[model samples]
Target chain A: MKIHGSISKTASFRTTNAVFIGRSIRLSLRNAEALIMAIMLPVMLMLLFTYVFGGSIDPSGNYVNYVVPGIILLCAGFGSSSTGVDVAHDMTNGIIDRFRTMPIQSLSVVTGHVVASLARNLLATAVVIGVALLVGFRPSANALEWLAAIGVISLFILTITWLFAAIGLVAGSPSAASGYGFILLFLPYLSSAFVPTSSMPSWLQGVAEHQPITPVIETIRGLLTGTPIHDSAWWAVGWCALILLLAILWSIVSFNRKAGRR
Target chain B: MRGNVIEVKGLRKKFGHQIVLDGIDLAVPTGTVYALLGPNGAGKTTLINIMSTLVAPDEGSVKIAGYDIVTDKNMVKRSISLTGQFAAVDEMLTGEENLRMICRLSGLTVAESNVRTVELLQHFDLTAAARKSVKTYSGGMRRRLDIAISLVISRPVLFLDEPTTGLDTISRRALWKIIDQLKERGITVFLTTQYLEEADQLADIITVIDEGRVVATGTAKELKSRVGGEVIELFNDKDDLIRTVSTTGSIHDIRQKLNELASIVSPELRVNIRKPSMDDVFLALTAKEMERSLS
Candidate 1:
């Protein structure tokens, strides 16, 4: 049959991506128990750190207020890695080869991974946010500021998710993809997540002070507390932009590599 | 409609130092099944992978449905679907959802996708198991679902890489029937198989590839013809047989000598002139290669 030609190229691409992303979301939702298990890890971490260790950390406020933003970032990092795992599983099962021969937009592959990652991270982020409120981690900011904070965090989730998806595409096995998540978990701890930078040793503090993640955390923390703009906010925005750009470039290159396009 | 739909010339691929495909050429016509038969490590899969645009050839040009696979990759990809030997269904999805996913990937709208999914499920006889998760499906069921998923897109050209490799007899026959139906619909099928019987049953054209090169190409009849027609299998005791043949003065030599003398002679020890089969053809081709190597 002669398929419709009236659909514009952009529309076709967008539609294809939406369909694939929608499929991934459906599959994930169907396995909601496993998904909830994924979310519970970060939620448990938030509870443990905020309530048990709340008094020991001197963050000039309740420990939940100090650690909740970091936990939210942790949720994003942990949850986004599932994209890689799922892609790896697809590769192992030969589903990727099936897609390779079809006429679908190549961008749909990336979009599917990113969208699914965002959806999953959003759920985990929601759970963390909910638990934070229950534990007295209310943000003093207005609604718009809270939205901005969530926006930046989601963007961070998206950028990192795409990067990990690419990694999973080239990974030799599913185990490799899941195991790689541990590498990303170490980044946030080195940032201003748990304690103030001054509390760390000088050399370690220097390393932590200049890392890209510290600014992201600080920016979210600032927005939550309704603090004014600081030099760190500019640095945070720069880091996020750089990460987003690099992730996109890397993903495109890796996709072409996987398909042997070049 | 029977003209060549896929044409490859001088295709070559190398992985580091090992060559996979070496200067291969092929032509597969529309509305027919073309079987590329080869043993393992013979570059059959690599050639299919290249033709399907899954891998780039180091040197060569390929055209599918008149579109260049490299420059017009998207267009070429649009006209084809591949179902690999392994099942490609998503384990988390039901059998029906897997086919629907492929329909969506092929740019079908939601309503269209559902229609196509139902059509494919019914065609593959998976309607009863449509709602069962693929993770719970049997091996044969999953294989059928995989083929069904590829067809959900309903492209004009399909590549089946050993579609029946591990299937049971009944499932294999079912798949063959489905493939026959596809050919009746004028879809060009490019398949690779180790099963000589499968090739004989399905291929309108057969290309025998070995050691990264095309050893022969023809209809089953033409390839079988290469093995010659007459045979004399004497079953006397070894020495007695030799003595009898010697006393009989070598019928083949006698026939050849008589032909040179412009006379016809018929050999008499109950000679058989049976048509050669595909196995005979394969042996002849490989035997010729062995002789060439030895010389």
Candidate 2:
């Protein structure tokens, strides 16, 4: 079939992004099980930790203020991991093959998943924050601090989402992607998100204090409570930027490798 | 050759140590159905993938719509569409959404995309189920939707790799009708199938491949001729009356042979003669290749 006319060489960046993002969001919304896990798991954890162990864990009489940041980190971590599962599903289901053959931007597929995951995690974070407020959590931050907190969280979400999306592309199955999520979910627990790193055992404190999640949670915690904005915020930004850079490169290389193979 | 939409030369592909496509060559003219007939594991899909730019060939050159598949891939992609053996439609999206998404991705404006989506839904008889998610669609409906998605921006060439592999007879015939319409619209079709009957019914030209090699390439009739002419069967209860004769003669000659056999053997013997079909051609050609390879 010889088409007489040539296709426009101009790539439609907007249209391609819209198509992929719309598809990703629509598909994620339909997966009720994944949505419930991404949203409700953090809410349940918030309720359990605040009501059950709030007083014992934080005798400072302001447990909600401390635990809310931790729960928000938890929500972001768990929600980003779902991006991997979605990417894995797309890879194994042959949609990736279809996408590869199209004239659209090559990275739009991964970008779509990353953007949708950011939206989902932000929404989940909002819900967690709402629940925390309802449970008597209060922050001393001003409007700028709140905006900075959101900016920091969004960056963190973007970084982790890309990282896991890469992992999902490399994973053998959706179930395996979920298994990879457990590693992310466990990070906040080991970090200072849930408690002061000083409270951890002397042998374990070093790890708990230095991991990526620790600096991020501490930054969010400091932002929310009007604490001294110190090196933790810069460290968090650096980690996010580094992870995003690596993840983007890894994802592009892996995606090309996968698409290049028969 | 100037009007050919697909030109493949010495096309070769290897998976690890196994050569899946062994230096094959082909040319598909514009607005014709070129059927690739092969048994399972004959590397039909590998060939399609290389042409469609989904996989890279280890050796050889493929030019689709006058664009080299390796160096000018985007041009080749913009000029062709592929429907794989599996339905590649997104199951979570509605049938309409799927079509519109593909249209939008192809750079169609929203209004144009919507109009095209509706037109395709109606054309494929999917309008009734357009609002339902593809996960709810039957195999036939999904296959139609998958094809519909590929046609969102009708390119010059379409590659259908076993498009009706698992479809029922009715669905298969329906897909064939759609493909025929595509050819009528001046779209070049490159189809791969294991069904000899399908190739015979729809192909303007047929290429028979086996074990990663092209065994024969010609029209269905031309291929059938390669396997010899009509078959004559003589049957009877008496063992001596039975004869297996292969001849390329007229019905009159067949009747005369049966009459001569009847006089010599048993008058009760029955004779049946029929044209050699694509099935016979496929079997004969592939079997020949297998024998030659073994020897």
Top DockQ hit: 2
The alpha-carbon root-mean-square deviation between model 1 and the true structure, to one decimal in Å, is 5.4
Best by TM-score: 2
Error of 2 at B182 (Å): 1.2
Worst 10 residues of 1 chain B by lDDT: B239-248
Error (Å) of candidate 1 at residue A48 is: 1.2
In the range B121-185, model 1's lDDT, one tens digit per residue, is: 78778899999888898878988898777766557788998999888999999889888988987
Q: Against the unseen true structure, what C-alpha lDDT does each candidate score?
A: 0.78, 0.85
Runs off by more than 4 Å, candidate 2: A1-6, A9-11, A260-262, B234-245, B250-270
Global Cα RMSD, each model? 5.4, 3.2
Alpha-carbon TM-score of each model against the true structure: 0.88, 0.93
User: How well does model 1 score by local distance difference test?
Assistant: 0.78
Q: Model 2 over residues B1-295: C-alpha lDDT tens digits?
A: 2488899999889888998999899989888999999999999999998899988888899998899999999998888888887888888889999888887787777787788888888888999999998899999999999888887777888889898888999999999998998988888889999999999999999999998999999998898887666766777765443665555777677667777777787667777777788877887788789899899
Tell me what TM-score chain A of model 1 achieves. 0.89
